[model samples]
Target: MNITINTTVLPHLDPDESVAFYRDSLGFEVRSDVGSGTMRWIVVGPAAQPETSVLLAPPAADPGVTDEERRVIREMMAKGTYGWLLLAADDLDDTFQAVSAAGAEVVQEPTEQPYGARDCAFRDPAGNMIRIQERR
Candidate 1:
């Protein structure tokens, strides 16, 4: 089996806000933007890694998803328990500062973990928890 990790879906209630957060705030490049209205899907990634990208997805926009499911997704997103994205950083402090300064909700400051990583966490505009770990 030839399997490659290409993209991960991160649910968003608003695509524009999520796009701004990932692109302008986190410094990720906008790889693609498709669809329109509430059904938009945006792909973003680090400039250095073009193959791997994160899909800023809108769950409520899917026609197959029921209203009940959309409600649940909204609740989860509001509670900051819906989406997650983990990334690697070259400098954790600088990354944290830049993201925080851009108005992201800071979950944690840059700190050395017992697991041997220096990392930080933040909640994007769509309530997704984005963790950045400094390359060791």
Candidate 2:
């Protein structure tokens, strides 16, 4: 059996802001944005990994998702331990500016990793750590 993890659902404090970061900073192609009353179900993927995508989701408000799950997610965000959302970009400097201009809080300035990745770290509006990386 060939199995692949194509999509991951991530907690977003504000879907719009997270979407903007992905779309503008890293130049991700937006698959959907209804702009209606519901929480925006935004999905983005590596330009090369067309079949694999990540979903920006709000704490599940559906009746199906139990309160315990919601509490766990909220607690995770509150503790600032949800880990980093890593993104790959063509230009590390430009992408850093793009995210900065969009008003993301910089956690770490762009720097070259020992392994040769030029990377910067920022926080999503929802307080998720996002790292933009470019290979040297």
Q: Look at candidate 1 and tell me the lDDT of residue 115.
A: 88
Could you give candidate 1's per-residue lDDT for residues 44-104 as a string of tens digits? 9989889899988887675898989988888888777888888888888888888999988
Off by over 4 Å in 2: 1-5, 33-38, 46-49, 62-69, 113-118
Task: For candidate 1, list the clashing residue pairs, or say none.
Answer: none
Clashing pairs in 2: none
Query: In model 2, where is the ten-residue run with the lowest total lDDT?
Result: 32-41
Alpha-carbon error at 132 in model 2, in Å?
A: 1.9
**What TM value does model 1 have?**
0.89
Compare the candidates by TM-score and give the number of the best one. 1
Q: What is the lDDT of residue 5 in candidate 2?
A: 78
RMSD for all candidates, in order, please: 1.7, 3.3
Residues 1-136 of candidate 2 have per-residue lDDT tens digits of: 9999788766776777777777775567777664444467778766778897778776675779888987887778765567457777778888788778877788889898897778989876667778878854
For candidate 2, the per-residue lDDT at 21 reads 70
